[model samples]
Target: MTLKSVIFDVDGTLADTEKEGHLWAFNRAFQLWNLPFRWGVPLYRELLNISGGKERLAYYLAQHPEYHPLSNDEIREIYRLKTNLFMERVRAGVVALRPGVRSLIGQCYQEGIPVGIATTTNYDNVETLLLRHFGVQWKHMFPVVVAGDEVPIKKPDPAVYVRCLEQLGVSASEAIAVEDSAVGLKAATGARISTIVTMNTWTYHHTFLGALAILTSLGTTQTPAYGTGPDGWGRYRVTVDQLRAWLV
Candidate 1:
């Protein structure tokens, strides 16, 4: 299989957005809404199993029946608030592209390999994050961005990845997906695309049974990724050439 493109999952895969950025934003939204409940790190970890911000909130409500049930509109409002807060954090430089992410994206661009985004996060969130890191021309750099709003279903399902593959004009075998959780791995592999799982503090314990490789992080020359990989793979960094070699 030849790697003609690289598809990235946002949220945790591109950056460590769960614990600090997302969790904080959710809690802040709850506070502003005067909700009696707050999602702690541990509680949010359980909710992370559910993809999409609104879905996570709905799941949390389902798990705890004591809280007042919010209508669909209310849930959307909450998600909107949380997204705004998250974007503010991004503007404040609270989140960043993960180690080696920018370099790897640059490598793909330089090599003429199309880079795409397949995420269960809202387009606004993706837009804001990339604007801060990739500047105003982020969309030009990433030609295909299939965000949560674009898909009826989210991760753990193949819809987003399938749509992304469609837009990229590539078959599953021609693209490699970079993900950070079991749900993402399931989504990518379900699309029949090989995926690499990168571990973060929130998702390191989750199973990534079908991933092509599971690394601690993308890693830089100074901070090498620590994880399991195919033979001849290196941890010092995950470059475009290395990804292509893995496909070979």
Candidate 2:
């Protein structure tokens, strides 16, 4: 099958938005709320297994009853505040696209291959990162953006990826999904889409069992590409051509 479109996951796949972006924002929210709670790196890393921000917070609250008396509405509000803080930090230029991301996206655009996003992160966070990186007209570049709030279920469920494929009017066989974690890999493969795994700091330890390729990053000509999988193309930097070859 010919590759018709490329769908991307936002958080770790697009940029290191988890540790540098959302985790910081969540800590800031807790501080602002005068809550005696903070998510250190190890705890936040574990919490990332949960898909959504509010869901993660709810899980944390349940684990530690001391933080109770915090209702669902309060959790939602805290997540909202965290989103705002994340956007502010993004606007301040702390986050940047992963290696080869801009080049690959631009290549796809130049070749008339539509790019879409399927992320469990909220739309506002998506907009913030894209606008900061791709400018005010980022929506024109990414025509299909199915975010967390838009989906009933999150990754490891395939709902978000399925929605993205639906919005793009493309079948799973005709598109490739780029993900950064095992949960995301599950989501993409569950939708029957071929996927590429690009591991980030927080997710590097997670297993990527069904990935077509698992790499440190979508490497550029300037950077060495290193990966381990049944796919042989991991020896060098992955390009649009390599992705097409993997479509099978």
Candidate 3:
């Protein structure tokens, strides 16, 4: 495979957005709605096993029927509020690209290797986060962005990854997916794309069985990544050249 493209998952792979970004936003929205409960870190971690935010909320509610029985419309309303809050958090600069993320993405852009995003998050969240970090021309930097609502289903189903690969004009064998959790790994690999797993606080315990590489972070010159992979190219940092060499 020539490694024609690099597809990234937004939430944890690009930035650690679960704890402070999405979770906080969800909790804040719940508070505003005067919902009886809030999603603490531990419970949120388990809820993350569910894919999309709306689906996660629905699953949580279904699991605990004792809470106020909100109709589907009410659930959507809560998620809408949460989404807005998440975008606000992004605009406020609460999140940052993970170590080596900008460097790697820059390398891909400069090298003319197409980079895309396949995420179960909404498009607004994606736009807000990337726009804040990459500026207004972020869309040019990441041309193929397949959000959760765009596809028929979320991660573990491969719909998002399939759509991303289609838009990027690359076959699964010619692209690599960078993801943070087992759900994402399955989605990428399910599409026959080789994947790299970058663990975060919420997903550190996930068993990434099919990932080509598993690392703590992408690694920086100051903060080197720690994990096992197919080659030594990721010894210091996961560079584009390293990915190319490893893929060969």
The local distance difference test score of each candidate is 0.90, 0.90, 0.91
TM-score of candidate 2 versus the correct structure, residues matched by position: 0.97
- Model 2, residue 158: distance off in Å is 0.5
Model 2 accuracy (lDDT, Cα) = 0.90
lDDT by residue (147-197, candidate 2, tens digit) is 999989888899999999999999999999999999999999999998889
C-alpha displacement of 241 in model 1, angstroms? 0.8
Candidate 1: RMSD to truth: 1.2
- Per-residue lDDT tens digits of candidate 1, residues 1-248? 67889999999999878877999999999999999998888888778899889989988898889989999999999999999999999999989789989999999998889999999998889989999999988888899999988988888899999999999999998999999999999999999999998889889889999888999888888888878777535665889888988886
In model 2, what are the clashing residue pairs, if there are any? Answer: none
* Global Cα lDDT for candidate 3: 0.91
Among these predictions, the greatest TM-score belongs to 3
Alpha-carbon RMSD of each model: 1.2, 1.2, 1.2
Checking candidate 3 for backbone clashes, the offending pairs are none
